[model samples]
Target: MMDPQIERKLIEIMRVIHESDKPIGARAIADELNNRGYDIGERAVRYHLRILDERGFTSKHGYAGRTLTELGEREMNEALIADRFGFVISRIEEMAFRTSYNPETNEGVVPVNISYFDKDDLETVIEIVSYTAHEGYMISPRVRIIEEDEELFSLPPGKIGIATVCSVAFDGLLLKAGIPVEPAYGGILQIENRKPARFSDLISYSGTSIDPIQIFMSRRTTSVLDVLEKGEGKILANIRQINLSAYERAREIMEKVEKVGLAGYFPPGEVGETLLGAPIETGKFGIAIVGGINGICALEETGIKIKTNPVSTVMEYKTMTEI
Candidate 1:
């Protein structure tokens, strides 16, 4: 077995090589280690590199420097896995302490139960439960299956069956039919129904509809009302052909906003064209808007329902020009 100290140094050297933009010399590696508070010399680093090269963990190029080999990469990955396991265990312990119950005093006693299921059965149950919950209803985490002989699929008139046979049947039908069951955000833009028209309406309301696809492509317009009017067919086609690169850029911009502490909800940005039964296409040409809750709210003010999921609250519109 390799000495623990030597193994640790070899791993650290491998990490430095993996993180470098180009092959690095032993002197540079020693300098970097010293900067990180390690008390190692250039000669010692070269000796370690020779040992690593002999073990097929590093490749030495005469003038260029040294680089990690595939074996070295695997070693670094293993180190990362070990670190992640330690992190997870630490967090679990923290949670246990936070939720610890004093049995003698009967304090901090939050009753909870754990359930286990076969992998296949658990996946099926999760799919059904997820679909039901996405429809905006609270559901019980505890699942119960009735035996064939004692099956009771229905409830009394007043007691609603949360996950009844009919509901599951409908979900299955939708799945089999290849109908998309994910919820989406975006709707028709409307201006007047919520309040009485004021003098500012003349300047703020431009009567002309804006194309959401154009706004998405440009990444400049704040509101959906800024794009040039286009036909619905053209808009939908453009939306279908949206450049994925632009979407990534928009996501980065939204992340910067959250990092600055302005956004109320910072969702892991995933840009897509559809949600559940609601397509991102609004009926009016150019007035269509697509985004998360805030975007949905913008269209909802005009009184259009946008389908969303339980996790939708974490998402916010990316079109806002300001915080």
Candidate 2:
């Protein structure tokens, strides 16, 4: 009702006056607030207007209603131009909100901002497994979970990693085979083959204090595709681009492996394994996608890894130059 809230009400009232094409009287404003579920009395509204006048957010026009001052106009303009998160926190009072138990989608309509996380904040590591092609055997790719203090894993340099995430609480089933399970926000997740978890070449979600080794589970193919399309912010971007090139190279290299039937980094009994009869050609992607806007990011000795990030959505800003 009428408490310190009056000042807040005053700010709102001043803003309404500032934006209106027509001047509004005190009684009309009070009526509007009440209609909008605020229970302020007319007298209280009048008191607020006077305070607003002192603050220069509003001014009196002789016998007419108040109007916003230059300061008020500037503040209003700033509010209009604020970011989505900032606007919700600063201006919005209430909103619709909901959550689900599934992975691919979840949205909260309530007012809040996306927290900027640091490395020290994340202690638990979640990762997905990659199909490692051992020299002697052609085995299907499986998950390899490496926990804290665990011995580091050694794999061939050519494995690729990827992941998908669920917005809701997921059952732990999606995690890699040996990896220790971290406390998830939701429950254990069910990982159908459609939503297979893979290794990520990006590393945006990797926190600073994290173990050098990590992996994560991704959602379905569609979700993974979306994640890949958007790209991880840091290391992943480089890796994804490089991966395209690497795939082309791999096809070339694999073909040579077929032609010469060479083994190891070398070829043809006592000679090099490469089709060109040389060492494997290595291309470099500077960094892995590290997380920022969306998804998780992490880094490894070789390159970076990314989950999902906001890059897929292209937001074209209307530059001042346009007008």
Candidate 3:
């Protein structure tokens, strides 16, 4: 659990550090508070600093005073999101979403924001809550197989990924960045290097549906359906031909989507049985021709990312550009 008020205070401090481009001290934060007319004292600021340090949100540097952790920076972005950024990022995540880094030299984290919600579906929320890991469901994806980087963070739903980070910015590999598609949920996520391989060798992930059965039970299907019915986006769903080479195999699904024209087909077989998440089989991506169809949906299902700590999020309210 988190202290909401304290969290807000921490975010305020983090924003100060971010904008300053220099280490910020508790005294500095105190002065800023006073300047902002908060009526808070230095003692209160010290207390807040203690809490931030304990939570790894702030660290004691050698001589630079204190700084926000990778986690802290990501959390602060919620404050940084501009009023209309939601629309801007959505347009981006659609064209291409890639996560690439080398573990031997790079261990930075990319922050991305995804929106997960039960706000409109209490019945669905109830079902998912009481939901246990399915028997054959292995909620675990076999395709999430590039098993080398178990310590890296996985992309969860409702995340706004921040790109361009290095070891100086974080301690692990950076994965994603950008904004979210609206009717979005909240906050951004930090993804670490999910594999030990280099960018040149890592297999590229093409966003496609790997769960056919889940189409009925999962939140993604519902979300896609909602977007389609409301025409929120030109969406494509239940895309099969997963495990496809971004250049070739997935083309089949693309062709079908072309004919169906974003209606999202049911896809052929038992998808999750042999596959799930992003199965990084590594060296085995066979040669296949680029399939078909141009740009299709605004968002493609990557994989199900669960919460590390369920943070309360106010649904799509603004963007980084707007705020």
Candidate 4:
């Protein structure tokens, strides 16, 4: 793999060329990159272009600058996605760090998953979310509701927003106690008799730019409603690994959070073992978290047109109300 710095410059240069009406020169590309806050000079731009040319991503027009080749455009598109890879993992860490909800007082901010649905579906939305909470499929029964025309994330016209406590609250709590957590992936976990069975699908956070849950939602793969009713089906879940040595401390924090009305997690599996069928590294144990978006998954199963941004933002615990 090329150095990240060089790769970024190459992608940007390709972008500038692709966006130009005519093949753009190294000087123009360098100037554009500079204006865009990159410290690249024409010499640097030319050096990067040679690399791109070697990769068949750009073609030199002699003194006419360079143009992105067919292969180059495709590579650029994939590179853009690659550049954003692990964004979900980064967001997870960011939100986890931002979380300050103390189990003792429960008065600090907690991470939340945001969803927007038609205002006309308010009655049904409430019913579904409440049912999910009752079924213990949500991170917490608490939720923050925003009516249309409210000052919040761009709520679409005629849409209302529902913010549910995210499972990352567990990560935050454990982290506050000095335990390191590595969120491995978001997956669809099979359930049996209301107990987690195994993961039937997974998307590792390290390889994806988009949240894995959103991808599963797009596929309409969750059987959250089925699991709620029949006690068997798949639901959105995430797997996180922690050092085996911190197991006891992590358990203590888990107990505290559960008492504060935030519930999500399976006890750690044995070191070097798989939990609910997801593999854990040799020196770590894995904890499976019930996804905070399970409630919304139920709503989607019911044929509601909803848009979701899981692990979107954080909100004060006190600001939300129990369903």
Off by over 4 Å in 3: 79-323
Q: Give the lowest summed-lDDT range of ten residues in model 3.
A: 289-298
TM-scores for candidates 1 onward, in order:
0.28, 0.26, 0.25, 0.76
| Candidate 1 global TM-score | 0.28
lDDT of each: 0.35, 0.30, 0.30, 0.84
- Cand. 2 Cα-lDDT: 0.30
The alpha-carbon lDDT assigned to residue 62 of candidate 1 equals: 87
Q: Write the per-residue lDDT of candidate 2 for residues 207-256, one digit (tens) a residue.
A: 21211112232321112223333432111111111222333343343244
lDDT of 3 by residue, 60-140 (tens): 775556778897777666543442234223322322222232223333212222223222332342233222111111110
Ranking of predictions according to lDDT: 4, 1, 3, 2
After superposition on all CA atoms, what RMSD does each candidate show versus the true structure? 24.1, 23.2, 19.1, 8.7
Instruction: Tell me, by TM-score, which candidate is best.
Output: 4
| Model 4 lDDT per residue over 1-323, tens place | 66787777787788778755457788878766664446889998888888888889888888877788999989887876766777578778888888898778767998898898888899999888988887877789999898765644445567789999998898898898999899888889899999988899998888887788789878989998898889999888888999989988988888877887888677778888988778889999988888898989899999998877777678899999988
The better-scoring model by TM-score among 2 and 4 is 4
Local accuracy of candidate 1 as per-residue lDDT tens digits, 209-290: 2222223323322222211111111111111112343444434433443343222221222334332222333321111112
